[model samples]
Every structure is written in C-alpha cells, then in structure tokens.
Target chain A: MYDEPYRWIEAVANRRQYLDDQFIHGSPLVGISCAQGVLLLTFNRGTEKIYEIYDRIALGGMGHPADLEKLRFTLLDMAHVEGFQRSPSDVTASRLLKNGLAPVIKPAFEEIMRAPYIVKILLVELGTSQDRDHLFTMDYDGMFAEQREFGVLSASSSSGDRLSAEWKSFGVVASLSSALEIGLRLWGVASLLQDSSTSPEVKIEEKDKPSSTSPSETPEEAEVTTRIREMLANETLECVLLDRESGKMETYRSLGQSDLQPLIPTEFQPAT
Target chain B: MGQQGDFLQVLGEQGYDVERVFSSHKVDALHASGMVTTGTTVLAMKYRDGVLVAGDRRATAGNVVMYDRTDKVLELDRYSILAIAGVPATAFEMARILEHSFKYYRRSQLQDLSFEGKLRALSTLLKNNAPAALSGTGTVVPIFAGYDLHDTCGKIFFYDILGAEFEAVEYAVSGSGSSTIRGIMFYLNRWSQRTMVELDEEEALTLVLRLMTSAAEFDSATGGIDTQAQLYPIVKGISAEGVRSIPVERLSQLFSEKVVNHV
Candidate 1:
C-alpha cells in the first residue's frame, strides 16, 4: 500500500510509533566502564538480555527478545566471520556497528514491505584501560551514537536521559563493586521513569521507602530504590562483566546471584 | 548446506572455498620443491590431574631449519588446544578456522560445542582439505586435546591426514620426530611401574621433555631444547579448570634438573 514516496514515509513513521508502543514496557539496560572493566546490567524475569559477542565485545538489548536474539546471532556471525577473515582485534564495536549491524538493520527498517526490527542495542568494547573503553547505543531506526564511559537503552528518551544523568552524578568508579551499586541504582531510576511515562495517571506505590544507604542517592532515587526492591520480588537482575583483569583471552563473565550477593546491597537483594 | 552452527559452511557461504584454497597448484609446486615448512614432534599424555601436551619449537623445510620457537601447540579456546605436525601454513589456517569455529558455535548456539562436536568439526576441515593432503601439499596430522566437561577429564584425539579421528586412551604423538619416541611411549605406558595416568604433572612434564630430547637426538628436524638460548618446548596442561601453559621458566628448571641431570 506504500507505493508512493509520501505513503512510504508515513508508513515508516507509523512503524516507529508502533515500535515505541511495543517497547513502552521494555526494561532499561545499563552499561558503564570502570577501572576493572565494563559492565552491562538489566533486570528481567528470567531470560538473558546480555551477551558476549567476541573476546572484548559485549551486547545488551532492551526490546523484543526474539528480535534481539536474531540480531544477536547476526552480529555474532558477522563478528566471528570478520575475525576469521581478518583478526580478532579487528572486530571492534564501531566496525561491527558500522559495517555489520547498521547496514543490515537500516535496510530492514526502511523497507516498508518488510517488518522492521524493534530493538534497541547497547554494545561495549573493553579496552586495555578504562579511558579507552568504547560504548555504543543503537536505536530502532539504525541510528547509533558512541559514548566513552557509559551507555543506556530504554523505551523512552526521558528514562534514557535519567540513566545518563544518574551516571554522570556518580562520577568515575574504580572498582566493579562500586560500579554495580551505581548501575543498579540507575537501573531503578530508569525503570520508574519509564513506568511514569507510560502511565502518567498512575503513581508509584508509596510503600515504605527503604532508608537510603548511599550518600549520593537523591530522595527521588531512594524512592526508586524501594520501588525496584519490590520489583526484585518477582524479577532478577542480570549483569555481565567484561573484566580487564581476568587475565584470560576471553574476558566476558556473567555475574550470578551468588557472585553478586556481596556486591548487592541488602535492600536490593531479591527474595528467595 | 550444513546446520546453523556449521562454521565451515558459514565460511563457504562467504566465498572461502577451503578445498580450492588449500589445493592451489602454486602450493602444489611449492610442496614438490620441498619449500613447504613443516612443524615436528607434538605429544599429549594423560597424567593424574589432567593431560600434558608438549611440542618442540622447530619448523623445517627439506634439509634447512626454517625457524625455531614455533608454537605448534595452539590454544583454540579456554578448554581446547590443537597440536599440529605437518605443513604449518595449512595447519595454522586450520587452527584459525577451528578457533573461530568454536567461538562462532558458542555465540550462535549459546552453549559450548560438545567435545565430540569439536572433534568432528576438525574432521570436517581435514576432509575438506583432502585434495591438498592427498597431493602432499598441505597434510596436517594433528593431535586435539582438551578438557571434556562431560567426561570430567582431559582427553586426546589424533587425526590422520584424511580427517579420520582416533582417540588415544593413554597418549598420542605426531610429526616426523614422533617416530623416534612413539614406540618408547607405548612401552613406558604399558610396562613402566607408573603408567601415564598415574604420573603427576612434574613427572608427566619430565617424561614429555625426555621424549622430545630423545626425538631431537635422532631427528634433526626436532629442535628439542636449546640450552644456550634457553628455548624449551611449549607445554600446556588441560584440566577441569581449563588450559594452562607451563611457563618457560618451569620448563627450563624441569629440563635441567629432571631431563638433563636425570634426577
């Protein structure tokens, strides 16, 4: 039906709106670089949203799981084939996005005849040190932006901004434990911000806001922490670390609940 | 043509014709002229804890030593290693293919390729190189050793030039220098008081060093150890924890005290 150029443009706009509606409930993903390495965190019911795409590269998505999986494998196929044809060190986040994912995703998204991919992707590459780390974020429309220390993906731009603002206020984190603390707190803020955007009429349940433990947490952030703790009752946090000090060729490590127990605060721990 | 996890098929789809690439007439001419460099003497044996894999650092073409300090034992992944015994060019390409294959499988499938699957992947690559192997242009008789998570122990598998795979229960050896010590390894494993399985890491390492030394003594292609240059064989241990390279310093100390002094 989108034979005319104007019709095609309108259809594409409609597709964007549809995709936004679909992702209104999408959980936000957080990625940040620390002294130890880089980490990607998200809370989910069970499925994993974080993945290792190569030796130093990782991927986290905040959209349709099936679409994310397909994109993940496509990226994997491209990465591994590129590494095989060229070199492992050549498979950087920028190259993968520029020459690999963007090319494929952009065409699919623009083709009015074909269904578009409704996923937001965050890819990170751990460098030799924290300063050199590369974090990139890709929107549903194939537009991508590169950041040095932090990247986030969510359904709403407001929530994404909230995550970025929270990260900036936290400053540089030297240890992974401290990064995890800040990441989870930002995740909490993003989730609440997304919920508020989706349903402005409804307010977050006013449960007993847990005593703010961190000195940096604002009153609003503390309220978000309590709201997230309630979410932890049914949902679990998934965190993947690309550690620089792992001393192995492969640096991607998934932090399990037991491993995160000590790093996670008491108020945030999911109920057993 | 193969499954989604088939790396060779993936490469094939990308215009990488393994058979053609390996069986090029130019490479055939080089092989006939005896200019194709070949690595020598790689061995793997089961010890009490895991498996010890060792390979001498020598690449030779005809009568000339092309190079030393060649790493024949290549770590393909966290748990697996490939020790090659023939044309380094073809073997190195195969090594790179297998390395990417494992990672590709893991990433696409979301699980590590099973040990048996890994064994077959190599077989498929070797089979694809049949023309090169048959023409004596790119023959690679390699020993594949890894910590099999399902088996909960280190395992060794050897392959012929034609891709036929055989499991070595006690030990496996390949390359030109292997002939010098294969029978001795068989004898020691069979008749010695401490079988290959019973030997500890140090003992296993000492045995491998002695085997390489003996192979070097009789085989000029094997650059077993260079005392002046402090060059030692590359030794890797595969256990449940993963692959760990035995450092050069440890290899040197063992070579002097155990292999050289016969302590």
Candidate 2:
C-alpha cells in the first residue's frame, strides 16, 4: 500500500524553506524577477515537475489564504492533470501569466499593490530573524531587488524608501562592534516609528540605591555590573547583537537580562 | 776512519753534549750542545660539557723570541683535538703525523679512533723520536681533548717528553708557562660548575684570554697578544655541533674591551 499521508508530510517538510531535521530532502530554485515584480517558483522532480508562480506582493507578510490555495491548486494541476512539463522557456513572467493560473492569482496581486506593509513585515520576519542569509523583496508591479546587506519590504513605498536610504547612508561596518551599534539604532528608530512594544530604554540607578553587602562577593564583580550598565545606556539600537567569539546571536533586549559579558572582548575594560 | 766509520761517530763527534741540571729534587742530565729553545706550553681541561684545550703562543730560541704567532692548538678529528708545546717545528710535525695517522685509521676501519687511541698514537710517534730528544735535537709535548660520544662527556689527555700519557680529571696543562696559566684557571674552575651548559662560547673565550694574558706576563716564552696584527689568542669551541674557531675580529674586540678597562 502507498503511504500517501507520510509522503505528503515529508513533502511539506521538504518544500518549506526551513527544516529542523537533517534527514529530509529539498529541491533548489533560482527565483528571479524581470517584469511582473519578483515571483518565487518551485521545481521539484519527485512531486510537481512544473514552474508554480508565487506573487511577491501578495505573500509579503502573513500570506493571503486564497492566494496560497490558488498557487497550490495550480501546482497540483500542472503535476497531475495537465502533466505540463517546465522547459527553460516556461520560467519567464510572460509564460507564467499566459498560463491558466494567472486569473486566479490576480486578486492577491492587486491587494499587495495597494498595501506594501505586508512585504516589509515578511522580510523583517524572514530576513533579519533567521540565522541564514536569504532574503527576497519584490515590488508592487513585480520588480525584484536582491539585498546583499539589508532588505526592506513594505506596503508604504515611502517607508521602504526611507529605511533603504538610512541604511545606505550608514555604509558597511568594518567591525562587529560598529555593526551592532548601527543595527540597534536603526531597529530602535523603526520600532519607535511603528509604535512597536520593542522600544529600548536606558535605566539609571540613583546614588541612594541599596547595595548588597555579601561577604562572598568580590569588588571586581561589582565593577563588572557597573560596566554592563554603561554599555546598555550607550547602546542606541534595538537589534540583536551577534557574539563573533561564541557564534551566538540574541535579541537586543535589556529586560531579557541575559549575560552580555561573553560578547565583550577581554581586552576591553569598560570605562565608567 | 772511512766514510762508513764517519756515520758511526761518537756523541762528541756529532756535537752532542749532556749537561746536568737540577730537577725538582736532584740533578738530572739533559742535552745542552744544540740550540737552546724553551718548550711550548699546551693544556687541556675537562669541563662539564666539553674540554678546553689551550696553548701559549711563544716560541723562543734561548732568550730571543723565534716565533710570536704560533698556533699550537689543532683539531685532530670530529671528537678530538691536539694542543702542542716544546720545540715549535718538532711539535707541529708530531701533530701533523698523528693527525694523518688518525685519518688513515678512521678511513680503513670505518670508525673514529677513541680519545685513548689518539693518545696512544701520539705517544707512539713521540717514542720514535726518543733518540733525537735524548741527543738534544728536539722534543714535543701535546695535550689531547675530545668529546667521548660513548661516555656522553669531554675527556682530556696530557703527555710528557718521554711520551708518557695521563688522563686528567678536570684540568691539565703542559708547556713552559702552564703553571701560571693553570693557577689562574684553577680559581675559574672553582666558580664554574663542570657543566657544559654553564660555560657558553663567550664565557669560555673570556676565560681563555684572561688566562693567556696572565701567563704572557709571567713566562718569557709566553708572548703577549699581537695588537698591531689584530691577532688574539686562537680559541676554538668543540661541542656536539662540532668544532668551530672563533672569528679573529670578535676575539680582537673582546681583547680590546678587556684592555681598555684595565686603567
């Protein structure tokens, strides 16, 4: 008996961009945009052997259910019923739109053209949030921009423009310390403008604050705490800082109260 | 007498006369007819790492300094060296003959002659010339130093005019000025821990020059360092790395520095 359910689970796990398990297999695709914004098309030999079109704008943030469903049907239809094989010629934007699937995919496309916020949110979620280096930002009408440094996707064209301009002005950082500072400041500004709950704040302790008199504690420990406070106050961003030495990245949240000493080099004796 | 009878002449006919001089205890007979020359001073001292072999560079014919630039020290082979004294030419010839003999033996046997073997060879060569020495023709005394790879340390061999060989424990000296040189070196020996690591190339050279200077001052046969020629005492260091003669320029610099500070 054919194990349809198990095969379907494996396909879903493999087809998705990310996989936690090492045993799963996945196919590679080169998603490019020429005329009709940027579109992602999957080519899998085991499953559907056809170019399935995905609207960049429509699937920006949280993808539209109707758009995803129509894409799924198109893929299945090409694989099973029509048995439409994808040659090199079938990969173009004109060929995809000329196919029968375009009519069903048009509504979600219009929605993305009206709202660019979905794209920005999707990019911020997938691009900056992931440990890997893969981010795609497609335009409203369908133009693609591959970002080498940082990518911004948004419904509001002006907001995306502002973020890109600001990021470009900062330029490439030579050291990790400088990158962290710049990234945090940009994220902080973005959070403030978006009115998000992730805004960072500096905490100042008064001179009269009660000090613990533990006999076991050394003076060096107290000095370290003070130095950490100074670094937190000086930090201008709300972005994650990656520890190059330990190869670990964490959210740049002061309230999380994680140890940051590992990120600081031993050569640095933080000044009061 | 016929021509053959001329060859069989008496000691007086050959201008050979035996004279008596006081030894340490009593009178001893020594030849006095021929040219009187002070015997050379040669010494070999066993140190922790290796042996130090030195010689005074003074060749005298009676009261006149015949040769002031004599190099009495010689490297016999990889492991051993010879330092000569007595008649300069005779001593040098003996050194050369022994060096050749050692080379010949090493080539034939495909192995190096040991320190003791080298001493025996030198004594054999000297024994062949005993008749000439008794007739006041010439005499040579040499000190041999070598690093015994089997023993893992340095060894020194001292010889007398009669070709009698003796192995010294720590230090040995031969030559007319050896007593004075030995006296200075004895004090230095006490300070040095018989370890080869204790004395480096610089310290060894310094010690040798100091001893040489003291010997030159007291002994008429021991000549002073040639400052005009920029020639200092010839110093060679032998270690596991092999024998290397110190550069004359470096020795001259060291000698000048020592001389300038002497007020």
Candidate 3:
C-alpha cells in the first residue's frame, strides 16, 4: 500500500511504532569498561544474550532471539573474515558497526517488503588501555553511537538515559565485582524505567530527580531490587567479560554462577 | 551460515585455499633452488601432571639454516598445541587457521569444540592440503597434544602427510630430527626404570633437553640449545588447569644444573 512517497514514510513510521511496542518488555543490558576489562551483564529468561564476537570484541543485545542470533552470526562471520584477511587487531567495534552491520540493517529497516530486524545491540571492544576501550550501541533502525566507559540498551530511550545517568555517577569501576555491582544497580534502574508507562519522548529533567550520587537508593531503586530478587529465582544472570589481562589469544569468557555469587548484592540474591 | 560452526568452511566459502596460497611461485622458485624452509624436531610426551611438548629453535633450507629462532610448537588454544615438522610457511598457515577456527567454533556454538572435533578439524585441513603435500611442496607431519578436559587426561595425536591421525599412547615425534629422537624414545620406554608417563615435570624437561642434544648430534637440521646465544627450546605444558610456557629463565637453570651436571 506504500505506493506513494508519503505512504512509504508513513509506513516506516508505523514500523518504528510497532518495533517500540515489541520492545516494551525487552530485557535491559549494561556494558561497562573497567580496569579488569569490559563486563556485559544482563538478566535473561534462559537463552544467552551476551556473546564473544572476536578476540577483543563482545556483544550484548535485547530483542527477538532469532533476530539476535542472525545478527550475531553475521557479526562473527564479518569479524573472522576481516581478521583473517587483515589482522585480528584490525577488527574494531566502530568498523564492524559503521561498515558492516549498520549498512546491512539500515536497508532491511527501510525496505517495507523485507522483515526488519527486531534487535538492539551493544558491541564492546577492549582496547590496550582502559581509556581507549570502545563501545557502540546499534538500534533496530540502524542508528548507532560510539561511547566510552559505558553503554546501555533498553526498551525505551528514556530508560537508556536513566541507566546512563546512573552509570555516570558510579563511573568506570576498577574491579569486576565493583563493576558487576554497578551493572546490577543500573539494571534495576532500567527495569524501573521500562516498567513505568511514561512516554519516552518526555525528557525528565535530571535536576528534578534525587541526586544519584547519594549512598542510599531511591525508592524506585529499592523496588527494582526486590523485583530483581524475585526474578532471579527463575531467570539466569548472564555476564561475559572481554578481559584485557587474560593474556590469551581469545579473551572472552562467560562468568559462572559461583563467580557471581559473592559479588551479587545481598538484597538481590535469589534463594538457593 | 546456517549455524555451521566450521570456521574453515566459512573461510572456504570466502575463497580461502591453503594449498593455493602455499604452493605459489615463491615456493616454486625455492624448489628450483633446492632450498625449502623446513621446521624440525618437534616432540610431545606424557608426564605426571599432563603433557610436555617441545620443539627445537631451527628452520632449515636444504643444508643452510634459514632461521634459528623458529618456534615449531604453536598453542592453538588454551589446551591444544600443534607441533609441525614440514614446510614452515604451510605449517604456520595451518596453525593460524586452527587458532581462528577454534575460537570461531567456540564463539559461534557457545561451547568448546570437543576433543574429537578438534582432532578432525586438523585432519580436515591436512587432507585439504593433500595436493601440496603429495607434490612434496608443503607436506606437514604434525603432532597434536592437549589436555582433554572431558577425558580428564592428557592426549597426543600424530598426523601423517595424508591426514591419517593416530593416537600416541605415551609420546610422539616429528620433523627432520625425528628418527634419532624416535629411536632413543623407543629404547628408553622399554629399558628405563620409569615410563614417560611416570616422569615428573623436571625429569620430563631434562629428558627433552637431552633428547634434543642427542638428536642434534645426529641430525644437522635439529638446532639444539644455542648456549652461546642463551636460546633454548620452546617447551609448553598442558594440564588439567590449562597451558603454560616454561620460561627461558627456568629452562636455563634446568639446563645448567640438571642437563649439564646430570643432577
């Protein structure tokens, strides 16, 4: 029905609205760069949401599992081919997103006849130094941004902003445990933001909110912590690290439950 | 991709040919000159803890030494090692492919490639290079060793130029100096007080150094320890924990104290 130019624009806008609705209940992911390396943490129902794409590159995403898997394989292929043709160090998050995934994703999204990918991905590349670490977030519509220190992918832009603000106050942590704690705390905030029916278009002024740097949690943070505790009983906490100090060819490793046990906040631990 | 966890298949689809890349004009020129760069004398044996793999630091071209600091034993992943005894160019390329393939399979499938799968992967590469191998241009006879996490023990497998894999119960040897090392190993295993499996880490390392010395005495291609330059063989251990390289410092101390004085 999108025979006219205006109709095609309207169709694309409608597709965006439909995608937003599908992502209303999407799980949130937090990727933080620290001295240890980069930690990507997400609370998922079962299937893995974090992956190692290359030696130094990792991926975390929220959306349709099928779409996510497709995107993951595409990235894996591109990264390996690039690494083989050129060099392993040549594979970077910026290059993969800008030159590889973005171009592929943008077209499917614009083509009304083709099924657009229902996914949002955060790609992290561990640099030689902590400050040099690169993170990129790609949207379903093929929009992406290069970030430093932290990257967040959530249901709504507002929730992403809330998580970003929370992460900024905490800053890049030095240890995996400390970074994990911050990631969990940000996950809670993202849950609160996604749970609330507030319009993402409405920007809540940061000054109006309680100072996030305060030691105590906001009321919403407390509620989300309880929510997380209950959800943890059945859901699995997936965390993968691109460890700079691994000193091995492949640096990606998924954290085991035992590894995460002590680091998990007492308030959020699921009953064994 | 269709969930094909085969990295070489992925590479093949992208037009990668190990034989074509290896058997080129440079190789032809080298063949005409009778100087093909070859790596020599790689061996692996079971020890008390796990497996110890060693390779002498030499790359040869006919009678001339092409390079002295060549590392023939390559770590394919955390647990797996590839020790080649063939054309250095072809062997190095195989190692690189294997390194990428293991990581690619693990990342794509979200699980480590099984021990049997790892073995087959190597066989497949060798089989694909049959043309080059049969032509005497890029023949690679390799010994593979790794800690089998599932089997809970160290295992060694050796492959012929035609890609036939055979499990070595105690030890395996390859390369130009292999005949001398192989003959000594057969005698030692039969007459020695302790088998190769019963030796401790230090004993295993000492035996390897002695073996290399003996191999070099008989085979010119095997460059034994370069004491003048303080260069020793590359020795790596694979165990239940993982893989670790024996530092040059430790090798030095062991050579000076244990191998030299027979302590």
**Model 1 lDDT on a 0 to 1 scale:** 0.86
lDDT for each residue of candidate 3 in B1-263, tens digit (9 for 90 to 100):
72778887788778876557655343466665758887589999998999999999988888888989998989999989999899988898999889888888988998899999999989988988887887777889999999999989999999889999999999999988899989899999989998888899988999999998888888888898877798899999999888899999988988989888874
lDDT of 3 by residue, A1-272 (tens): 88899999999999999898888787889998899899999988777899889999999999999999999998998899889878998998889989889988999999999999999999999988898899999999999998768888888675555566677787647688889888888787776676563344323433355465422223366687787787677788899888889888778888989888888777777656
Could you give candidate 2's per-residue lDDT for residues B45-147 as a string of tens digits?
5444566676666777766777777788888666678887776656665665565455434432335666667767777767666655555556667787777
Residue B98, candidate 2: alpha-carbon lDDT: 61
What is candidate 2's local distance difference test score? 0.47
For model 2, how does the per-residue alpha-carbon lDDT over A95-133 read when each residue is reduced to its tens digit?
A: 332353344433333342232111111121112222333
DockQ of each: 0.56, 0.00, 0.63
Which regions of candidate 3 deviate over 4 angstroms?
A198-219, A270-272, B22-29
Instruction: Indicate the fraction of true inter-chain contacts that candidate 3 also forms.
Output: 0.64
Candidate 3 root-mean-square deviation in Å: 3.8
Off by over 4 Å in 1: A1-9, A200-219, A270-272, B1-3, B24-29
Report the Cα RMSD per candidate. Answer: 4.4, 33.4, 3.8
List, residue by residue over B1-263, the lDDT tens digit for candidate 1.
22477777888888888777777354467775779898599999999999999999999998889999899999999999999999898999999999988988887778999999999889988888888888787889999999999978889999889999999998999999999899999899889987889998888888889999999999988996998898999999999989999998998998889988874
Against the native chain B, each candidate's TM-score is: 0.95, 0.78, 0.94
